[model samples]
Target: MAEITTHQLVKEFPGGVRAVDGLDLTIADGEFFALLGPSGCGKTTLLRTIAGLEAATKGRLTIGDRDVTELPPGKRDVAMVFQDYALFPHMSVADNISYPLKIQRVPKSSRHATAAETADGLALHGLIDRRPGQLSGGQQQRVALARAVASNPTVFLFDEPLSNLDARLRLEARTFLKRLQRDLGVTTVFVTHDQAEALALADRIAIMKEGRIQQIGSPREVFARPANTFVASFVGSTPMNLHTATVSGEHVKVAGSSVPIPPSARSRVSDGDEVIWGARPEYLRWSTEPVEDSIEGSATIVENLGAAALVTVDAGGTLIQLVVDEDDEPEMGARGWVVPRIDRTLLFDGASGELILDDTPTSP
Candidate 1:
């Protein structure tokens, strides 16, 4: 296993489009790191650059202790699993898994033995004789993973390797993949647009936007304490509700209602500063009567999700959402109050969209 590092990495395409822009990152040895972002965010371009499939426009690329910026894909000591499971249609499972060994000029008997061992680990033992065309989608994905594992490369690169699977299969594959990666302890770099997949599979994730990294942290850190408004809105299961408000002493005025700012955020802005107040759906509590430090709103929609209900309220012109227990479902068209959990509230600078740090009491 090897650590991958990049410094000032850049990849610019024709028409003045920059896919990856001056990214500085490091993936530790045996670490499972994920690159997550929306479509056209340059995650795939960065992965391709790491695999030597795409040349970097400018920067240094290193694997372990060697500089590999100019090296070709074959010499990078990395194996990639593509989204489409790029397996040979005519090759049997065993043959496909052992193809890397063949290319390295290993003896046929040794290749078969290694293939068998890898196949058994991935539960593909009985499908050795089947070709890609005859295998199920999940089975084919396993074969692809088996092939990649059989190579025993220093690093594994996965470009949405489970995107094509059904929801159930995807969950299963995620669990299996995590176990497999743990067992092998090889450094892995995964690229995906799925936030849940990244959160579930990665030890650390780098969220990207417009070819630049927005935030890098553990899943819980990113989800619970987003660095800025973009991350606060992007990483949650339900997008965070953000509204423009004016700071007044220790409180902010939201839709003509005064809401106390969390003690943690008290010193971030002056009394007249305009800031964005953010709260996740789960952090908002609903009540029929006006409550302390709450904004009154009219419930416009109520969606009954099996375990919980989503209550969307219109507070003046701003829309807010609250996730409540099914037993506490609110009636649509009813006027109610939505109170944010002060401890969990977030404040962002309106002009810059940057998080406003509380710097007040040193500890929470």
Candidate 2:
């Protein structure tokens, strides 16, 4: 129900460790936004800072329209769900859900009634009297969400809430969480290291690293056009294949092949320049026969992925991966050609590791 905005937000530790460094961001009202990065990448700290659990070292934080930079967690009107689905071990499900309302001094009758209604909505009405120890992991997670919903806060913050669930249950809970957020329409910020989780759940994602944001975009935009090498190497199920190559005319020499510069990077490249060329496995063509501008290599390894397989080929000491139908998976050591898609290929500056996405090159 509220948009969250931060201007020059900073959270630093006593030892000069800057967990979140002068980051500026805005999450739209009722938007599902995610903070994605590797472990120890300040995502949790950032989430905690927004929740008022960790005070900000500098800058401003506003929820909806109020400047809440100096407010306590209780006064911020935000609900947070931690990775472990922190529930009261001794309290019954209904009691746990109604605890926040009780702290607000709501009448016992009214708070219980509200808790019952929220529990029913999350399919936990039947187990309202069960303690946390009696519930399954998935049930505990729902109880945590029910507790947050009972408060009806303007914003929701989640710190890897699905990490405790088993894989199958995680998938189910993911769908459930998405639907829950859509139905309630609360502005939510989720922090996680899982790329798939971020991709599947977020309306927009802020990709972070070392306490700084690297890119912000929709799922498809980040996947198709990564802002830089770090994002290109991190956003996909199988990270994009990135390799160093020397520019020769309009082509880059790599993997024992001369691949044309991608349309997006053509005007940014020149002869004798060293660049990092990249392509996702999903975008490359698989062939047993030789073709134009194709990488020639022998299949070194094949990884089965349900209906498809990731084929790793050794091309003149450089490894290139391509996804092929399970039926078309090549035998080990089979010779083949994997062609990088001309239009979809990516180029990054060799020294800067910055994506060369525009006409103006980054080199001298």
Candidate 3:
């Protein structure tokens, strides 16, 4: 296994566009890490650079204490599985999985034996003779993964490998991939624009934007304590409710209603300084009447998601979403209340998108 590191990595293209700028990463041996961000944010560029497919304009890469910055992809001891699976329609599953071993000139008998074992382990034994054209999308992806693992490379790289599958297949593939990583203990680095995929599979994730890393931490750390507003908003579904407001004495006014700001929140800001407030839908509740830490609004939409319903309310002018039990869903166009759980709220500096210091109050 290899621990990969990059220092001050830079990548430039024609027309002087810098796709990746001063990026640094440290991935431990046998750890599953992910690079997550939206498209054009330099995620794929960074991954390709690590794979040696694209040369870095500047910086150094080391794998297990060896400097490999200048090595070619084949010589770097890394195998990459792409979004398209990159399988040949003409080759059977067994042939494709054995190709990596053949390239390294492994004994013919040994390669065939290893291929059969890998196919059985991946539950693809019965489909070994089938070509990519004859298999379903999920089955084809498994073949691609089986091929990468058969290489026995120290590092396994995935670039949106499940993007082509449907929702159900994607979930199943996610489980398969996670289990495979743990079972093989391969040092893996996967890149995905989907936040949920990152949260689900990664041991730790590095969230990126505009060619720079926003934050790197475990999924729970990133979600519970977002480094900034962008991360808080990007990581969750239904989006966090953000409201701008002024602080005066112990009161904060929203839509001309003076709601008492909790003591914990008051200590974070000075008098008259603006702050952005955030709360996830799950931490909010609906009520029949306006109350403390609450906003009155008209129900705009109600979406049933099996066991729970997502309620969208138009509060004066702000649209707030609330996650509630199925029994509590309000009818659309009905008057409702928005009660926020202050303890679960997040505060950010409006100008810099940075998180502000807050002393969370203890619940009685």
Task: Give each model a TM-score.
Answer: 0.96, 0.97, 0.94
At residue 343, give the lDDT of candidate 1. Answer: 84
Q: Kindly state the number of residue pairs that clash in model 3.
A: 0
Model 3 worst lDDT run, 10 consecutive residues = 255-264
lDDT of 2: 0.92
lDDT value, candidate 1, whole model: 0.91
Steric clash pairs (candidate 2)? none
* Model 1 lDDT per residue over 1-364, tens place: 4889999999999888999999999999999999999999999999999999999999999999989999999899999999999999989999999999999999999999999999998998788988899999998999999999999899999999889999999999999999999999999999988889999999999999999999998888787777889888888778898888899988999777889986667877898999998889999999998799999999999988889999999989788999988988888889989988998887889898887876543332
How would you encode candidate 3's per-residue C-alpha lDDT over 1-364 as one tens digit per residue?
A: 4999999999998898888889888999999998998899899999999999999999999887779999999999899999999998888898899999999999988998888899898889799889899999998899999999899999999999889999999999999999999999999999999989999999999998888899898998787667888888888766777777666667665544545565445677777777777778998898887687577888898999899999888878778888989988888898867887776776678689787756564431
Best model number under lDDT: 2
Q: What is the C-alpha lDDT of each candidate?
A: 0.91, 0.92, 0.85
Lowest lDDT 10-residue stretch of candidate 2: 355-364
Model 2 TM-score? 0.97
Give the poorly placed runs of model 2, Cα more than 4 Å off. 359-364
RMSD over all Cα atoms, model 3: 2.4
Order candidates by lDDT, high to low: 2, 1, 3
Clashing pairs in 3: none
